[model samples]
Target chain A: MADIVLDKVSKSFPDGTVAVRDVDLEIADGEFVILVGPSGCGKSTTLNMIAGLEDISSGELRIDGERVNDRAPRDRDIAMVFQSYALYPNMTVRENMAFPLRLAKLDRATIEQKVAEAAKVLELTPLLDRKPANLSGGQRQRVAMGRAIVRSPKAFLMDEPLSNLDAKLRVQMRTVVSRLQKQLGTTTVYVTHDQTEAMTLGDRVVIMRGGAVQQIGPPQELYDHPANLFVAGFIGSPSMNFLHAAVEEERLRTAVGDVPLGDRLRRELAAEDAPRELILGIRPEHFEDAGLVDEQTRGRGTEFEAPVEIVESMGSDKYVYLTVSGERASAAELEELAADVGADGFGGGAANLVTRLSAESTVAEGENRRLWFNLEKIHLFDPSNGRNLTLHEGRAAGALAS
Target chain B: MAASDTTVAAKWRWGLLDVVVVVFALVPVLWIASLSFKTTGTLTDGNFVPREWTLDNYRTIFSTNQFVRALGNSIGIALIATAVAVVLGTMAAYAVARLDFPGKKALVGVSLLIAMFPQVSLVSPLFEIERSLGLFDTWPGLILPYITFSLPLAIYTLSAFFKQIPWDLEKAAKMDGATSGQAFRRVIAPLAAPGVFTTAILVFIFCWNDFLFAISLTSTERSRTVPVALSFFTGESQFEDPTGAICAAAVVITIPIILFVLFFQRRIVSGLTSGAVKG
Candidate 1:
């Protein structure tokens, strides 16, 4: 196994559509890197190019630092698990997993042994003789995994393998995939449009948009300290909320109210020009019920009431949409603010902000529009570039508890 | 809930009415079957069912020379034609479906045009060609004509079938180290079997029922197929109203077609629908 590197990669379809453009990424040996983006954003295309399923339109692709632009998928020693699973619907589970080995022309005894082991690994021993049509979605995904595992290739390329499964199966399969990746320790490049999968599966997730790499880092790093607004908005569920706020003598004031700028934000703005307008990003779980509320508490850790517009009760937590001070924030504006710190005004009507609170925290919709957010956990961004001003350590701690 | 349940029951009753409409369309085929089973005496009597049941009419025809030979000839030609059409057509279909060679689309388009061409238009030219090749009055002559006539339909249907196969299977086969040819042969061919069968069965029925080509092309008994043989059973100038013989021959000839249809009807319907519809 060796590091897979793409130096300024780009793909242009015959129809003159550019799927990915000037993307640069280097995955270390045995690393689990996920490419995440919105639908049709070219994350899958990038992975396909690496797997040799799609020819690179432009750029250098190197496996082990040796360029493999012309190599076939098998010659590149890359195994792919397709979004459709692409299991041989006609072939039995054992045959499907054993196909690559069979292609490798291994002896019958060896092929059988390898297939058995793969089946055992995937808990498909009982399903070995069954065709893909008989397997459940999760089981088919595991069989797909088993197929790649049997190859023991330099790297595994997976394209949205979990998308076909139901919600619960997708979550369960996430853990299975992570454990499998760790156990195999083969360099893997997995692509998914789902942000939660990107965060949960990748050691380092590469967030992509419009066939370009937006940012690459550990999952929490990208989530907490997203390099730009797109990464910030695209990396989290219900996404990050962006609000238009202005800096005034070490204090930032918004339509809702005023809050003091903490040392972290002020210091990051110290060497640079403190612009009049700034974009503030807040994650879903950063808000809480107001037990303590004040400018001092808001400076680092405080709470304030914002009216709730929508409430979605997930079993473990409640996702509340808060319109701060009746100021409307477009998703694009929020995304832009997340990318460019000290950004210009995105203030419109009512700002749409999402908050994840404990399920027991009964913030009933239509009961009260008001809710509270923790200012200490709030994300400060430049309105112009959507760059985060404060690099708080708490941002990188882990996934939000909720 | 009760109101909704009543509505659903009413909808099912409407569905039953639609099935009755469909059954009305099938009355003619049922009538023809009933006509075939009756004695000529009953048939002339205009009775739906014969009061006097007799196997003598069926027995008389089965024991005759022309009817038996014609039956054998029809089966042979249909079988040969279908086999050739399916094998060659499936390969041609796969090539047209998957390969990126030059003029591929044009070739496919030309084949479709050939299928839609009236069989009578080609009969004279084909007869002359067979004559020059000295293939007239031979099995090869018959096979050649049937193959040409059946091709466009076969290729058109099977190509549609081939298109339905996920390109990924061929890619997976490629990943499994099969060359393009091997991938087509091992993966595509097997996967497309039902469609091929469907195409073959339909093509066979076409060849079997074709009297114009079979009668016009073959000169004598040495090469004459079922239709020619059956027409001869009618006799020349005598105007012999061997109505029972004709009916018996019709029933005999139809039995195999019916059996063939029964064997592959489900597959034909499924394959045809699959080719036409997709996600």
Candidate 2:
């Protein structure tokens, strides 16, 4: 295993198009780090730079405390699993798995033994003599994984290796990949645009946008405490509901209702340089049916009644979509995220909020229902900069405890 | 019942068209075969079939040193030219398909210009140059022009095949601890073998079928290919006709082409149409 460090890594093409900006990342030995963002976010570019497939324009990349920025991909002693699997079409599974060992000049017995071991782990023993074209999609993916693990390289680099598989197969392979990485204990850098994979697979997730690293932390930390509006909206499944609000006397005046600012938020808003206008962020799971909340527990949050536009029952919970009378949050980050998720009318005047209510709640479509949003879970962001103004100093620690 | 009736009528029309096409393509070949089996006395009979068949024409051509030497020259020159062209074309095609070097477009444009250039225009200049260089009656003279003309065809076909190969395999190979050379030999070359083989057959056919260059560049049987040698065939005396012998030689030359197409027809079809669609 190797520790990979990128010090101010950047990648720019000859035509002056910057694919990756100055980004610093340190992946620990045997750590599974995921670089994730929307398409064109340069996550794959960063992984390519680490793999030495793409040249670093103006920075140093050190693997195992050795400067390897100029090293060839083979010389770097890394293995990459491509989205296309990239298995040699002419080679059988045994030959494909044994390729790196053969290239490294391993003996025949050792190469065969290692390939056999990998095939057993990947359940590809029966397919050892089958060419890649004859394998199914999942089998091809397993072969790609088998090829990567057979070498036991310094690190593993996977670029959307599961993206080509069907959703059911993708989930199955995700567990297999995670298990393999743990069994081998190799430092792995996985690049993907799917947030679910990023959250589930990586030990630490790096959220990036526009070729820039926005945040690097645990998946739960990014989920509980997003550093900016983009991460807040990008991390969660249903995504965080955003509403435009104006700072006022001891309260934030939003279109839904007046929300009383807690002591922490009041102190943050009273700062000398605080802006009068801000964006309010709340995750969908932070809201509950007001009727289900007890009196003492109800005091910890605020309640507002709105007509439910749509209700989707997902067995465990109901996703209630509500239209509140207010201007939706308008920021470049949210707009880009809306475009990324294909959420139409996100920035329209009527703010649409999706709240996950318990299955026990009897909320019907087109009926007015009171929803209680956790006040403590609310995030306030600076509209101009997209910075989460109310982000606590120990929020990441708090996320870990919860 | 109506659908079945229409299907029957359509099958009949298609069967008629297939018969017409097969007859149109095969009649000349049958005629040539008949001529090759006919005796010299029956050569001028002007009948579709020979009254009496004989293998004497084949035996005569096989016995003559002139035909034997020309046949040997044809095989050697075409094989050598094809081997050289395919190797160079593979390298050029791979680079054109995968690499981003300056003047790539210019190289493609030049090859295209050469592919479309009229061969008749270059024959005179090439003939003069070969004479000046003392390569006038050598196999190298004919091989040179054959390679030059076939390079563009080889490059276009091979490059189209190369483009269909996922470039990611090379990167994966590198990550799998393969040097660039190793990656090409182990991963790319094997994948590209069918395409290279197909291109080799095409280039060989082009060189083997050349009559003008073989005749103009060489003055004797020393380097004269079969096509040119066929023109020199005279039945023993001025009164004799060499038509049967010529037909025998033509049929012999066509055997290899027919076998190649029959063996690799599927591969040739796929190689030609591979990159036209995204898989």
**Of the candidates shown, which would achieve the greatest TM-score relative to the real structure?**
2
Best by DockQ: 2
Off by over 4 Å in 2: A262-274, A344-348, A394-402, B1-15, B235-240, B259-279
Report interface Cα RMSD per prediction.
5.2, 4.7
Interface RMSD of 1: 5.2
Query: How many residue pairs clash per model?
Result: 36, 0
lDDT of 2 at B56: 91
Write one digit per residue (lDDT tens) for candidate 2, span A1-402. 899999999999999999999999999999999999999999999999999999999989999999999999989989899988888877788988998999899999999999999999999999999877677888888999899999888899999999988899899999999999999999999999999999999999999999999999999989988899899889988888889999897888896688787666677678998889989888898899999998987877889999999999999999999999977788999889888878755446788899999999999998999989877788888889998866778372211111
lDDT of 2 by residue, B22-45 (tens): 999999999999999988778779
Instruction: Give TM-scores for every candidate, taking all chains together and pairing residue i with residue i.
Output: 0.78, 0.94
C-alpha lDDT values of all predictions: 0.75, 0.88
For model 2, give the interface RMSD: 4.7
> DockQ for each candidate?
0.18, 0.44
Question: How large a fraction of the reference contact set does each model reproduce?
Answer: 0.23, 0.58
